[model samples]
Target: KKEKVDFIVLLTQSEPELNIEILEKYPEINAVLAEEKSEKYNFVTYVGEKPIVSPQGNMGSIVKIDIFKNKDGKIKQSLEFLPVDSSVPSDKEMLKLEEFYKEKLDRDLGTVIAKNNVKLDSGFGENHHARYEESNIGNLIADAYKNHFNTEIAFMNGGGIRANIESGDFRLRDAISILPFSNKVGAFKYSGKTIVEALEHGVSSVDKKAGRFLQVAGMEYSYNPKDEVGSRVSNVTVNNKPIELETIYTVALPLYIKNGGDGFQMLKNTVGTVEIDSEKNIDSDIFIDYVKKIKVLNPKLEGRIVVK
Candidate 1:
């Protein structure tokens, strides 16, 4: 019965063109079903006259293909999309899923962690501004690493902060949502010159919303956005003392940045690189612990990053 079918559908997340070529080897396969590269809904394209049906991820929609045989013995195909409405009432299976998720993820982890609201000033949660200037939430997150690792200076990439939290009860879910990545905390001994170079790279692409912006703790610096990229940062200091070019300062940051993620190549070449508290410590867990310890969390921008 399978051999008698007129259409062959291949479901995959790989490149569409490669899948089409593989399907062509089988002459019996007239039409191939595959997902769109862009994951756009209701998208249909032809690869060498073969109909390819692509569906969006997360079951965003159901793709329906209708094939018709013309009177002249030719075949024609059309597509339809059935979007998934999450607001619809749950079925029996969905109710079971709700129960499963609640048992696993919906437990009270802790009481209110902050007395005041923690602001997330990422240019209204936009990318470009977060990496360029000081943000309350950014400062808080960077402080977490600094405190946990007991480093002289710590900073995190602006892109690592995923969301903002209002003044209210803090939960494990909140921390998870904010620091979604599983980046481990890392520390290294770096010179003031290297620190300056890293900060220079951080602000190099501020106009493009690049993710390399450094949100720091235990140190502060002033920079002119209008200045040339490598020469923007100045007045850098660690512990209120001006950064000495010959001094090797201990810095704490995510392993992602330490390994040159987000263009932090200078960090990877630090004097003595070390992973703090083992690589098992996750970013979200550290942030959660910091909030729990501080209780009344209030992080403010105090010219840690002076942007003129």
Candidate 2:
């Protein structure tokens, strides 16, 4: 008698390309349980007779799968995505832990550091205008970085500004929500030509909701979207004077960009020269301290990033 196996399921959290490669290498695989998500697929995606499913159950959601064997010895499965929202019952122990963490977080993040006079926006998905246009939130972050680090210019990525802040009391949590990353303030010494290249890189994808869009302080620039990418940026100025490509400028930005995150290989090349007094201030804390010092949040779009 031979041993019987109806299904071979694979568990992986790799990229979709690797997952597909694995399936191709092992055609015997019938299903893949993955943490990787793709908006293109809903519920389940099939590769021939094989099915790929993602159990993003970390969000308190539940996934139930039922398997059955027919008389002919073929295995069939059905999947259900169960919501764990208000209808679901909470575990008492988990609830206690949640309460403990929530209490700690509220106490730590509840301090009102500043008062906002207007709503500052980052963006709203594809409809987000901050990607190509100047935004107050972007201005706020950039200004904070530039002023705190005492740099000639600061270039904060518009996409890094995640949420909007409304008028009234601004708390530490508000700052964290806007800049929810572990990245610290980083400064670089770069030639004026590299600054131009950075600005060009920032505006190169003006047609898409690209994260490379730079939110700036201490400079104003204009670009023609219809023009070619490398030459789109024009009329670059720092301190109201035209940018001199030969001059060295001290620039403040997130460490992520300094490390070539978001395809900024140009800035990445200029990483070794640290021109700032300190590089240990986490971005969120920097934003908070900036707000505390300012005491009022009144960021405005001052024609910093212009599109012609």
Give lDDT tens digits, candidate 2, residues 254-296.
8877777767888876734555565456898888888999998
Clashes in predicted model 2? 0
What does candidate 1's lDDT look like per residue over 1-308, in tens digits?
35666556666544455666766776455566664433344566676666667766346777777888889977777777777777657899989999888777765544445565665455534433666788888888889888888889998898777667676666667677778878788778999889989999988877755568898999999888789989988899899999998899898888888898766788888898655554446888888888889877777888899988
Poorest 10 consecutive residues by lDDT, candidate 2: 35-44
Worst 10 residues of 1 by lDDT: 119-128
The local distance difference test score of each candidate is: 0.76, 0.80
TM-score quality measure for candidate 1: 0.69
